[model samples]
Target chain A: MRALLVVGGHELRSRLRDGTAPLIALVAPIMLATLFGLALGGDDDPPLKATIGVVDLDGGEFPASVQREALNTDELKGVLTFRQYPDEAAARGAVDGGEAGAALVFPAGFSEGVGAGRGGQVSVMESPESPLAGVVARSMVDRISALVEARTLAVRASLEAGVPADRVQVFVEENGAAGPALSLVGDPVAGGRVDLAVHYGAGMAVMFAFFVVGTTARSLLTERQNGTLDRMRAAPVPLWTALVGKSAVGFGLALVSMCATWLSSVLIFGASWGDPLGVFPLLLAHVFAATAIVMLVASRAKTDAQADGYTLGVAFVFAFLGGSIVPVYNLPEWLRGVSLITPNGWVSAGLSELAGTGAGPSAVLGPIAVVTGIGVVAGALALLGFRKGRFA
Target chain B: MTPALVCEGLVKRYGDKTVVDRVGFHIDEGEAYGLLGPNGAGKTTTISMLVGLLRPDEGSVRVGGIDVDEDPVAAKRLIGYVPQEIALYPELTARENLRYFGRLYGLPRRELTSRIGEVLDLVGLAGRGDDKVDTYSGGMKRRTNIAVALLHRPRLLILDEPTVGVDPQSRVAILDRVEALVGDGMSLLYTSHYMEEVERVCTRVGIIDRGRVVADGTKRELVAELGGTDRVELTLDGDVTAAADKLRVVEGVSEAVVTGSSSIRLLVAGGRHLLPALLAAVGDAGAVTGVEVVEPDLEAAFLHLTGSTLRD
Candidate 1:
């Protein structure tokens, strides 16, 4: 154990003095996260307001009411601004010219159809350039149409039941201004909000964690080539102790890089990592797994160039599969399934759950267990490689 | 007293080929034993097994009476290995590297510090201990490598070509330092292809070739085993064959041969003692123009045993 500490401390101190490894492990990840966060608009800045054109051709109380409600709805107030157009041609022109994201046109006699217990018709025009705004505008038009349909059903039911006309008119007038007939309540999505900034932050951290693999493998190969490893073996220290010490250096650097990225995401970008207790263990397990993988590569590699190529290839493949460069949610289902097979995938999934949904410690247990298991298996393989004299 | 290191019938093989076959030797306390071999002569391989870095296929290595294969950690504790390559971390200071290896040997902090200072001074790098190893000259790096091995003060110091690339002056310094250590009662198992180095430092020599020790003994013993004869070349102005015949009858001359029309070579038991009679014999045959005597050394001994030069 003392041998392990001494060797490990020496390895770490040497790396720290070298400076290149730490720069890649820490600064590179943070830089990637910042770039991705900026691109994704994951910060707390307000969203852009979309301009929507309203064309009321019905010249009736119902059309005017629909327009007023769509424009004045609390949910759409800051998000969607409206412009009243004189005609369909004007509204459509505004949408086509990109002056408005979308246009809503109420056809002539649309209010009369509802008054007579018949369905009303409305047309929505949206530009392809502003898809988000167009979708929002269409949903608002749908809500107004739903209200019209509900009123028509109520009026038809009253007449069929032989209610007095005067009472029916009073009912229509009273209910028309109330609200939409079907009020939709939202439930949380299984994975929660896919915060782009946090996703990229965690992804970049995990991806760059693998970058240390190349350095770790190169260092191992160099020590072997330079005869330092042989010298160490000749010392009183056990071979396993030296191996453990070298692995600890990689693991320690990875752990620090991962934690620093997480903390920076939280402090700088306002990213919530949910439960610290849950996230910390997963990070440790991830570092362990990453370190084991690198050690295994180093043990098997014949030269520094071979180690570099192998490690970089593995890191990239794992990063891509694990959705580090792109969100797994955005990937195909089959691709996402493939991601789950990698430790990076498990780590990303665990971090996403913790950061996105405020998941508890229990939520990350399975991933942590799997990652730790990988570390154990890979570490064993690495030791076996060492025993086989592959590193020699 | 127990020998500092003993390897009995050490054998190592890779795949179907044998790299080291039944090579065995021992280093006694205060003895500087030189393992002289040409390149690819299994010197490093044998050393590796002895130092617990490699397991012998058919032998046992005991360092300070501890079996290396059975308890390598204990055996290793008794051995300080200086590998051919510079093993110290290039980015770390010489002092830091020594301190690190010292700690690995389980030395106390104060003791390790003092030992580092002592080794630095011993290697003549006391003032430059704080400089990073990479910044040092090649000779300095080599000294630091040796210093690291001495940090634990092991019973046996195994040096594998410790002066391979060093300048002549640095080589002399290293040899001087190694000799001083031996004088201080430290055992050494030194391997080198340089015959002069072996002759100057080693009390006992083992010449290995093709995974086997072809010759092993003290320098004088090995030389005597090779008939203990020195060569004398006498350049004459006339009748070389007649001069050779006269030299053959000299008191200490082992054999005499005529090589050219004007030169006669004599194999003498002792050239310096036999030279006067050899001169008279040469004068009896012809007028002597020049005389040259070659003494029997490790190089000649090695060539005699292996039928090859040490450099080859």
Candidate 2:
């Protein structure tokens, strides 16, 4: 343990002393988080900025009423601004020229036909190039069409039956009773701040853990090249003990870096981690797994350059597949399934669930088991890759 | 006295090339042994195999009575090594580096602290241990590297080109320190391509070429076995083909090799007897501007045994 600490201290000091390590490891992650967080938005998501224009060609008896109803709908109040143009050509031109992203056209007799128990087309025009705008335009049109029909139908039905406006309002209110309840797990954490912190903390730790492995592997290569391996071999310490000492240094350094990052997150950034007991097992499992992967990579690479490239490629791929950048929930189902096979994904998922909710600690168990299993498998491969009595 | 290190039939091969082929020797306690070789001669490879960094294809190594392959940890504990290249962490202070290497060998804290001071003084870097290694000169860095290796006070010390790139003064200082250590009874295996360095400091020398031991013994013994031949080169102002023929007939002269120009070199048993006759012969043909009689040394012995120039 003392030897391990000694090596760990050296590794830590080296990392702090290197200007590049701190920049990439700490500064980059924090900057990325802040930039991405702001870009995604704060609480109370406003409707995204999307340009929508309308060409109402319908000059009917109930046109004014239709316009008033369109203006009052939920979709139009804040989500969209409907601009009435003289013709579809002008609106289409505006959309095509990029002045607007989408255009809507209400055909002639559209409101009148709806009043007479008929329907008319509310054409949603979009530049196929802007697929997102097309989607937005279609959604807005659907809302407007529903609102116009509901108002027209209610007015026609009441006038034919000679019902007064006040009575009709009372009847509609009475019938619009309870709706279907939304189906989901349970109440989420009131604020997103805790979830965000745990997600980034676990992810950043996993990412930098790979760097620790890469750096240690490079140092091993350097030792071998410099003939120190042979020197050490002539010493009293066994080869296996030296290897253990080296690997333990990497493990301890990575652990300290992760712990410091965690502390910083909790104190400075207001990050709340999961249960301490739960976190340790999870982090321990991942650390070994990451170390094992690094060792295996180092063994395969004949040069420092090859090791560096391989570590980077594997680390990033695993981090991505593991859902470090985006939540597994937001990822495509196929990708989420892929993430389960990687230790990083399991760690992120396990940590987020454990730290985010007081009651959902059980949600972490599956990921924990998977991560530990990966560690075992990777550790076996790493040990196998390490040739015995070969350092000198 | 027991040998500080011994290896019998030590062999190591990489792929199709036998890098260190069936090489074996021993360094008695308190002896400074030098392994001299050219590039690709497996000097470094042999040292690495002995130190337990590489597994040999065949044979065994014993350092201070410990079997390296059978029990590497025990074997390693009894040895200290300094590599050809600088391997200390530049960002760390010399003291920190010494402490690190000491702790790596699992030295006790108090012992390590004291030994750090002693080794620093031994390498002549006593008060400069607090400075970062990068801040030190090349010679200073080399000294610290040696200090790191000496932290454990191993019975056998191995240095691979410890003075490869340092200034002449630094090289002398290093040689002096190495001699002092050997005098104090530590066995050493020093490898270098510098013939004079091996000739000056090594009690016994092994000349390795093409991954095999070509020659081994004391300097005078090997030189004697290779035969007492001196090289006498004579530079004349004009063509000396006729003069070379006349010098080759001298009693002590074995053969005379004439250059394409007005110079000739004679391989003779003793230059003291052959020099006057050879110089008179060169003077007979043309004006003799330069005459030199060089005795047998490691370089001459190397050329005779390997049939190639040592510099080549």
Per lDDT, the best of the predicted structures is 1
Model 2 chain B worst lDDT run, 10 consecutive residues: B303-312
- Quick one: best DockQ, which candidate? 1
User: How far off is residue A353 in model 2, in Å?
Assistant: 5.9
lDDT of 1 by residue, B264-290 (tens): 666677787877778887776799989
lDDT of 2 by residue, B21-66 (tens): 8899999988899998877788888988887777889989998888
DockQ of 2: 0.36
User: What C-alpha lDDT, on a 0 to 100 scale, does residue A15 get in candidate 1?
Assistant: 78
lDDT per residue, candidate 1, A205-290, as tens digits? 88777776567678878888888888877778776676767777777788888888888888777877779999889988888888
- Writing each residue's lDDT as its tens digit, candidate 2 over A99-133 gives 67688787887755654445467887876444435
